[model samples]
Target chain A: MGISVLRVENLIKRYESGFALDIPHLEFQSGRIYGLVGPNGAGKTTLLNLLNLLEEPTEGEMFFEERRFTDLDPLDIRRKMTMVMENPFLFHTTVFKNITAGLKCRSVDKKMWPAMSKEALRTVGLKGFENRYAPALSRGETQRVAIARALVLKPEVLFLDEPFTNIRQRDIDLFEKLTKTINQEYQTTIIFTTHDLPQAHRLSDEVISLVDGRIIEGSIENLFEGTVEEIDGTQSVKISPKISVSVITEKRGKVNISIAPREIILSHGAIISSARNSFKGIIRKIQMEGQTVIVNISVDEEVEFTALITETSFKNMGLPIDSEIYLTFKSTSVTIF
Target chain B: MDYILEGLGNALKMIVSLDSEMAEIVFVSVKISTISIILATLAGVPLGFYVAIRDFWGKRAAITILNTLMALPTVVIGLLIYSFISRRGPLGVLGLLYTPWAMIIGQTILAFPIVAALSLSATQGIDKRVEKTALTLGANNLQTALFILMEGKFALFSAIIAGFGRVFAEVGVSMMLGGNIRGFTRNITTAIAFETGKGEFALGIALGMILLTVAFSINILFHYFQKKRM
Candidate 1:
């Protein structure tokens, strides 16, 4: 909606083990909390590392504030951003020092250090811990202090790399509240990665799905949840009167389904396939990613999903926006949660 | 049997008497060893941190060389420095041949690889995410390396103490480089060697006792750091 704060094009990171992070294109808007949801080895941390400037991409271009990321001084760029890793590591000093180390590095005013750090500690629910020895802190306390350490800087973008595991539900609620407050009051753009789908759905203003190295664009809008219906023991969920998606699960009263955009096949007419799921929808939007195309479709008035196809396939089909199309998916490809 | 008893009695008297000769030699030993370990700590900790954090070509080979140098024989180091500072040797013109500075230089070389190799091991055992945390928290490359050095501070101190222990008890470097100059350059180990060679076991046994105490104290420090790391 506004000028993008961070953007990547054709990002690729390759390991000697043959694993890679191959992002064709992605963008992050200013002043909005975004969540990266994916499974392990799905390249969430890789993306975070690249965005944080901790690692250079094997092949790609990154733009920050409309300038090439590599063209700017990386240290200056990194100082403006902050990241909290999954494992909390504090400087070998008092909690006060841990919270103020970045401020000291940035040459913040000395008179403001104590009060700012104390308020930061309070915000992360770590009040009265200013003098505590960092190494002696419990794991949860350490994580909270880490959050305080990052938040005290009041960075432009705060990147959290899967740091919320093992947190209690109450702490999770507090974290959610803290993120919302930071987003609303401070206008800090929060980008966090998580394996918890519901938390992502709850915490993020928008969510990006990364599966196998590629960004699943429009994944947040495409996640559909509905009451389960079993017709002759075929498990399905009815999102609307016109749409029911087949699922691979047996036990279901209510369930959530996620279909990768690439898994859904688009056709201009009824397509013959052994696949169990098919629905009629109109193309709502279309955008190109690299050489491929992403098509957003709405089967019901309220339910929208996306499909990935080639530009060649799109041109051969010659379907314009709002054109009716049949989409099909195999039940095995439908993930239930 | 009588000589052994007499030596023991004389050593006790010498230690209680605070003999100036013994004190001066002790002072020289500590001075050179202290300077050497300080230099080693300054140079080695950063090198170790770099060895721990950065990945470059031939890093494994570099680490292997350091690990090998950890067990390097003090006699070999003595001989190497001896050749360099000897007349007709490359560094002979400086004329530091039989002085305390020569011993200091030799001991510094001896202590450096120990501090570096141990610090490297210590850095490797630290939390791997600490570097990333430092970088993300606004530390530049040099500051991040210093932060990693800080994280392994205990080990680095222990490395310094261990280096002190090695050079303090060392005989070869001081003997070859200091020429065992009694009032000027003779340290605990070389003095003991000279006194023992002359059948004057009293001062030799006394210095041996001091050496044991220093080594035992260093061991205790090493163990304390080991426990802290765990």
Candidate 2:
């Protein structure tokens, strides 16, 4: 494990609209990609803004490299990190000007700006785009330029909010590779937010799941990466050699699918149901989260699935740890990304 | 109709011949208005930018006050400045009254509010993201403010041009403050007012034509920048 680069304790952000983010503790290590995954309005962007020092937390403290945010000059601390907004606003100028804006602010030598901007643009596969007028560029090109603008600063920590939301599938793959290259080559700590669970799992060394402004353990508990295939005239994803679950996707390729834990119906025995996928498994663990019970099940001793059921249902079924159980869910419950 | 045609013909002849007195009047008008507009721009742009970006008490009221001042009467500004520069007033020792300096001062006052108020609107119309983007990229508050001003450059340019237009064609300030001294403090508007009062319509008509041309050109430039901004 690397040294902790950023740490937050008892952070709280309150808005006049009655939305508040209260996080107890979190830490980010140096030179590793961390994915913050959550649905819309889950405070992902808000957290990114706080961590990047774009806004101060209402309570508690944040530290960068063991220095409290309040103790460090905001300009100095912000210079060490940069954030590329989800919908980046590029300056109305040439791409070169936009990319070197930070360098100018930092009072960097004017002679090195050209080389640095070119290299950053090349990193984003936008070679020779320095002279392009920002307002004339396409949306994808603008996003790349924004990334290059941040990359040229060589920040110690880079924050990206929904970096791939506006990108096409092919470019998304390219950008994902570019992101990995940046991390591996430069060793810059990267923290990004996305609601796409699979992308988070595929890219980050750690995935932090947030729901309704709080981090939860089982939000991504049922995520599975598999190859989508049509078998026996039905579309399904083959998770393991012995497990193929039906899905409702026309896509044929490697994909990631997630089933909401609450969507799975826990049964004592397999009964006739409209659900397309049913598996018999042994419950490996049972846990409680407020009024809901989380049941971790291992099927055929190969794949694991987590299901959420109310405490009342768990008691009615009289389920216990290490007990055989039946789990069933409809194909539509699977979200492919 | 014949009287008007005769005046137009003589006015064209005088303009084409570049009458020295007429040329001097035009020069004075351009010089004083240009200097005044420049001073107003220097003072107003930053003032407008600061007000647009910072939140303070009575900001809305401040903006309302600025908007009201945009329509400030030229004569009222002349009267207010006249009192200050008059021999009995505080600034009388400078001897600025009845001179080009006096006119410049009045015009600067007349144009300042227009420039500041329009610039406020220009900066306010800028996307809020510009500030955040610059700050996230390591810009200090001053640099971020500069970046936002750059982003709204076109509209700000139009603001300055609007200020120039307001001061360039105003007659009340120049007539009252400059005392319409021919071959010295006289400008286009004052020249037109003086020549017409003397029943010498040719020079007045020529200066009127020049004034219309300048106003038309300013409008063209303003519209060009406004379009580019959009």
Per DockQ, the best of the predicted structures is: 2
In model 2, the fraction of reference contacts reproduced equals 0.95
Worst 10 residues of 2 chain B by lDDT: B140-149
Worst 10 residues of 1 chain B by lDDT: B141-150
TM-score on alpha carbons, each prediction: 0.79, 0.81
After superposition, which runs of candidate 2 have C-alpha atoms over 4 Å from their true positions? A220-337
Q: Can you tell me the CAPRI class of model 1?
A: medium
The sequence of per-residue lDDT tens digits that candidate 2 reaches over residues A1-337 is: 9988899999999999988888899999999999999878779999999998888789989999988989989889899999999999999899999999999999999999999999999999999999989988988888889989999999999998999997788878887998899899889999999976757878999999876676666555577779999977889999999999899998889977779888999888897889999999999988876688878999999999988899999889999788999999999998876
The TM-score obtained by model 1 is: 0.79
Q: Label model 2 with its docking quality class.
A: medium
Count of backbone collisions in candidate 2: 0
TM-scores, chain A, per candidate: 0.67, 0.69
For candidate 1, list the clashing residue pairs, or say none.
none
Best by lDDT: 2
Point out the worst 10-residue segment of candidate 1 chain A by lDDT.
A216-225
